[model samples]
Target: MSQKTDGDIKVPSKVVVAGFISTFIEWYDFLVYGTVAALVFSQLFFPKLDAFAGTLAALSTFTVGFIARPLGGIVFGHFGDKIGRKKTLIVTLLMMAVATTGIGLLPTYDQIGIWAPIMLVVFRFFQGVSVGGEWGGVALLLMEKAAPSKRGFIGSWAQIGGYLGPLVGAGVLAVVTTFTTPQEFLAWGWRIPFLISILLFILGLWVRLVMGESHVFEKSKKAPVPIASLFRYDTKNVLGIMAVHGAQSLTLYIVIVFFAGFLKTGASFTAAQSTLSVVAYLIGATAASMFGGWLSDYTGRFKVVGAGLVLSILIAFPLFAAAATGNIYLVMLVTFTAGVACGLIYGPEPAYFGELFPTQYRYTGVSVGVQFGTLAAGSTAPIVGTFLLQWAGGGTWAVAAYLIGWQIIGLLGLMALGETRGKALEERPGA
Candidate 1:
């Protein structure tokens, strides 16, 4: 699949697989923290607080990682634009591996007291920083490396990988917890998922090593200041990227990650039930994204995203109503439905984001735009959902209302943007 030109710059079809691996590792490390935070971090690290307070505190830590994403995008994105995608990607992987591993080694509250939570926050912040750099780099590498005609399908590999991470993390917890008691899981069993990230680290490094640098980046001129060009030449594109990406960013965390907390607190679901539902939902999300991305090649990207936003709007109340039913099967069904909606929204994003900027500033533009959206939408979503839940005394409408707002913002952003599906990467428009 690598398309090599006259000389030696051949882009392998394997770039799609490489893209999947990159996001798989990145999101796997990221989501496990949220999964555990919802299920057990409250007990392990913040046992002093009562159930509601402890859950809130734990969910807050999950948001901390998201807060650091934009900064990661800023720093790593600068270097990625100045230098190249491969080196910047290598650094992000290292940061994620180190932080994820260190998290496994941290002593719990009983052993380390306040230092446990402080250290967890510090490591989680770095994890955010690492992933902040990760998405744009991977998306750029894949979309730029791919042929224009196939960018949507190829780029969706990132979305597939994104789902794979949480899928794997949730699966691990579901299995591990099956064997251990609640007492044992809180004490030691939770560390297995974090520790297992070392294998992902090794596997990711190998895949990255086999991949070549992007031919698009290699051929493009280096901007004197890439981000400056992004702001000056492509301001609207940046905003459009944020809005187009906003809803899915928030909904993934809120509807998927936050739902686990909701199940545990309000619905009395078991940890296994919550995590297993994630496993099934992720499988559906992966398939839906691949189909969505492929379909976007035929329909315009905006149409696919617009349809998805509409679906989210229609199902907003019903999805939560299912959750409130306290029937685990019904909750899982609605989660899968939302996963389908997310896949459609997420499928076209990597290609869509890349199309928004010229090669000179693509890394910075995409990174800044996507990371800011994550900060605004992704990181804060769970917090907002939990707060709404608390305020409404466990009402689901407020959460549904929050999702509608994201969809509307994203739709507005899309309306102002032009479609760029088959456009050549070098054909930087308007800017």
Candidate 2:
């Protein structure tokens, strides 16, 4: 066997920064859509429905992106496992830009009627496809490049965008809404956030161009058929990862995506107010993720995620009740606190998932797990929550109960997986 050297093991700092920045940029694209859906999309795209129904309709479109994610995962993850992470990432990033810019230029239902929303959905599908393919590559880039000793802490950086993306998206929407009249904002201001993605896309593209491939991926053995190998050998690993990851997705989208709109329609808060509340949740989530990373390093990845799942169960009713009270401050507090629990789970899963499969097919396994898991969890949570509210006669209690029931499934998932903490990636096969 060939011996490893310093050059083989060391990954550059610029690549790491680019990973963080580009991850932020790509995710920012998705969050902007999320922000707009919760704010102005209902009025512009589906003005005929009642306020609640229109918001529900707009949120359903948001799910379209998540639904496309698994396909993105399959396509992108395949190439990422075949080629290298960096090249495949460039493709996904560019795809994200084109899709986001199209959304910015799309005509509204007022202007084009049915054609308008159909176009928007098409662009949104592109966004989902690109982002779906994107996360696995981005996460692997970071996790594979980082020092093995600091896998939990350093790999956690892979999700910095997880915090900043929503924060920036909501902040921008809040700014545009606060400054412009509702009429002016609806007509033009809403497009500003989407358009700003062009600049972000360009910047992220440059950083990616400057960076290189993951050191571990470059040195590892290639699977003859990555995705097939993943299913053949790692079926149990894939299912376990999906359940654990899906729990976090359900928690985040239910709160950030669904609850944001619910604040506007159910809690009677204005769009700006609802957006601001989401900002609070993102801030809490981001902070919690940072802390969770540090905590996971000391404890195990599964332990940290388990605690977060437990927290989700405990806080479901209170978090929903807090949002229902129509107090923005209380809503912010509960959202932020709940987000901390989400961070705990979100922070470690990437590193944990990366460690589960062999390097020969790590990208495909994690991407498939993360993306396919979304259908059951994040993609459907908003739609499910909205209906749950309607089923309970417009009360949050049913939604809260549904959330508790959901977490129970994730808890069971956590138990199925074994610990991977401190598992070093072996560069040489059959060592």
Candidate 3:
């Protein structure tokens, strides 16, 4: 169902828009929670605890969402394989919307006793599950429809949503907090951002409704087997994909999502300043991500990913040190650099990882790869970074050293693998 636009490139606008909008909604729900966890959730949800302990509690609740990602992947992957990608994704979208909007309505410590944080944990875990289910289908839907040469560029659209998700969340939160008195903001104004997710989800749903099922997945439906066969037969490929995904997750959640909080709490920036800087960083990252995907088409995924890892190692300490010095310009420069590095890794990942498994096993393979990272590196980095900051007397060195170490791990993982550039989807059996 390709439509001819002015460029006359045969393209499915509805599918592309659906894929983009759906991912935007999913990540919007996920990122807002992360932004709040880093800044306000610790104060709101864990109000009774001391600052450090409260931060830890908030992070732990956030990680609970990560902990559920694998299960979501498994469940959604199973149905995506058996029933279809479109319907399975629709269900995840609904779940995410409900859980996210519910988080806005929950009572605090004064009204609900222990149920406040308890309900937050439950809603967050559901959000995690929904996101885990969401990414695999969104990637599959887009990559399946795109031309081989253009798949990298197309797939990177999802990464754009990832960056934009935080921007929207931080931007809205920043605007709301700016106008409100601190007392009013801390009381109920913060809930406005979470409540607004209902509108985002509804808009995304409207877009997704107009789209059709992916031709690739539809073609594969002729003789589909259970998704379980993927793990049972291709365990080695699964493990390899997991490693790469771990690298993406750790770099993303640890550095990008939590960096604002780190700057605000540890580096002594005001919340407004931190949010604005993060929005700027994300904007740069979004632009770099699209460019990185285009570069991968020419340069290859392995090289681009490997280069990003090396850059991470080299600049980790320098970037943090610059930010620690309280130079506003220096902070923006380093943060923007970090965002670009994340873009380099994230941009190429959808196609790279999708190519690691066969069409029949693609959903399970990508989901497992991603969620494994979420469970291991992605969820733990923020908490670990916080502890490292404390241990290092709030110095930037420890946080930088920790991030660099993980990047080195990802570099080694990428270097050990063979390049998969220029291989046709059908020619590459695993893919």
Backbone clashes per model, in order?
7, 0, 2
Mind giving the per-residue lDDT tens digits that candidate 1 earns over 90-154?
88988988998999999989998999999999999999898899889998898887667677887
Best by lDDT: 1
Q: lDDT order of candidates, best first?
A: 1, 2, 3
The 10 consecutive residues of candidate 3 with the worst lDDT sum are: 1-10
Candidate 2 clash pair list? none
Ranking by TM-score: 1, 2, 3
TM-score for predicted model 3 compared with the true structure = 0.88
Q: Give me the runs in candidate 2 sitting further than 4 Å from their true place.
A: 1-11, 37-59, 107-115, 264-273, 323-328, 426-431
Write model 2 residue lDDT over 27-101, tens digit each, in one string: 676777776786799999989899999998897788788888899999989899889999999999888888889
Kindly report which residue stretches of model 3 are placed more than 4 angstroms away from their true locations once superposed. Answer: 1-9, 35-56, 109-114, 221-227, 257-259, 264-272, 392-395, 427-431
**By summed lDDT, which 10 consecutive residues of candidate 2 come out lowest?**
1-10
User: Cα miss at 387, model 3 (Å)?
Assistant: 2.6
- Cα lDDT of model 3 by residue, 190-252, tens digit: 788889878878877776777777666665532245455675666766666666667666766
Error of 1 at 429 (Å): 11
